[model samples]
Target: MTQTTGTAGDPPYLRIVATIRRRIADGELAPGDRVPSTRQIAAQWGVALATATKALTTLRLEGLVEARPRIGTVVAGSSPAGPAAPTAPTARRRPSPAPDTEPELTLDRIVRASVEIADAEGLAALSMRGVAARLGVAAMSTYRYVPSKEDLVLLMADAAFGEARPADAYADADVPEDWRARVEVGTRTLWGLYRKHPWLARVGSLTRPLLVPNLLVHGEWMLSALDGHGLDPTTLFDIHVLLYSHVHGLAVHLELEADAEAATGQSEDQWMDSRAPVLRELVDSGRFPTFAKVVGSFEDGYDLRLDALFDLGLRALLDGLTPVVEG
Candidate 1:
């Protein structure tokens, strides 16, 4: 699609803001009509994700649009100049409610609120102040419960990891007899958690792992599965780490892709499509015959499905490890 550009001298984001404002003013986008998402705005306006986000923020502040959970940004019911609505400024200026009206601030509440913010807006948008803002308390209020942003993130990761109780997955009678089956269940459970909270993948890494108790529960489950196999400690632990790394290594892309999409305003498919010329040039070079042949063999272009890759990698890992573990 052709990029929308505003007046020559205007800033890129302002141009985007003006374009959307005109659409609303001209009745093209009515109240409750969902506006283009940040990615869409980025692609259409040929601007960065930050620019698109800024344009939307401006619209929201102007009372021209409102963000609806699960619905996205939509045109506001009232005009921007109408009676002052409960916008950001209004929310910021809201008088503190009576002690009875305000809910008690607890560590759990603070962590949950922080997770919600991270989940909805991403980890980058998460801040101590933002958490407090979301919780409707003083910025310093969250500090009383959680020492700092780092500590809060650790708590959030632990809480998220706690959601899936690995031990509870297999009850007394329902436990899988085969070690491979048990490992599969454990790994898949971890994968499911990562899928739910994409940002969780970015919390820690292989070299510097998250030492939270909840995360260790999953580790315990995996280690327990291979316990009675009579394998040496080093080999067994190596196998476990390998399996865990397979899931984590692939899962890291989940958040990275989301971040890239937000920053570039291009979906994975769009990004790949834009690289078609590069791919074509590589294929035409004749130096990479095998790569070209494999790529050309696809009836349709390859789509990188992470879920499928996870399953394939898991099976292959198990297959390779079977001989080693069984012996």
Candidate 2:
């Protein structure tokens, strides 16, 4: 399905289909990977939804993809044909920054551009040059506001974290909800935001935390919620930190799955389906009794449900804290 020619001669819809087909042919798009939604394709390629739909329909017609009920459209099979061309280059050479627009390269603009870039691609594809190109500015122009790519990334990370802040009215409210409940609410909100912007988990560092005000507010709220608990501030902070880490850690896998879906067009379920034969073989060996038993049951083996895990972990952690609070 991979086309050697670029988009020049191909019709818009055809080009889109071919590009995705190329990704599929390469290892980039794997079997059971989710295809980009109509809305996503439109936004990403700057095409109309009709055009995107046509392209997606083309994929379906060619036996390359199938629609999954919950996960959307994913690659139909595991062994896709090899791509005729090289992998798509994420970066293109940039000209100089426009002098007129030079003064407008503010931190906010820079951060927003970085987010947009990461939103389209994964965080690994994000770079100063990439952001600058996305902003239609020279790479060096970004450094005027932020000294280095590292600094720009830190700013981008903080800006992303700050996106989950509650309104001032809610911020001031002294609700009677249990501290654990409050923390869980905040953590879930943060996790949802991360789901929206999968790149957020790439911002590393537990200690020497970034000083973004809104992000600090999340920490402040977590700390304040634990006030009545007898645990010292350090221990209280650690728990919240651990909670954040748990969400962030799990988010990385979700992000990768998202990337795999986008890059390969395979849904998690589709992936599991394609790998089921191998998995069944391993499970049949009887080397791991508990795991084998779990894999034998579709209800246990193929659950894409995250709520159960999240709820279970939250409850277990809170249960351990109940004794500390009561004592």
Candidate that would win on TM-score: 1
Off by over 4 Å in 2: 1-97, 166-174, 207-211, 262-265, 299-301
TM-score of each: 0.75, 0.66
Supply every candidate's count of residue pairs whose N, Cα or C atoms clash at under 3 angstroms. 0, 9
- Candidate 1 per-residue C-alpha lDDT over 122-167 given as tens digits, one digit per residue, 9 for 90 to 100: 6775678656655656657777777889999999999999999665
What Cα-based lDDT does every candidate model obtain?
0.78, 0.68
lDDT, candidate 2, at 116 = 62
- Please state every model's RMSD to the true fold in angstroms: 7.1, 10.2
What overall lDDT, based on C-alpha atoms, would model 2 receive against the true structure?
0.68
Return the top candidate by lDDT: 1
By summed lDDT, the worst window of 10 consecutive residues in model 2 runs over: 88-97
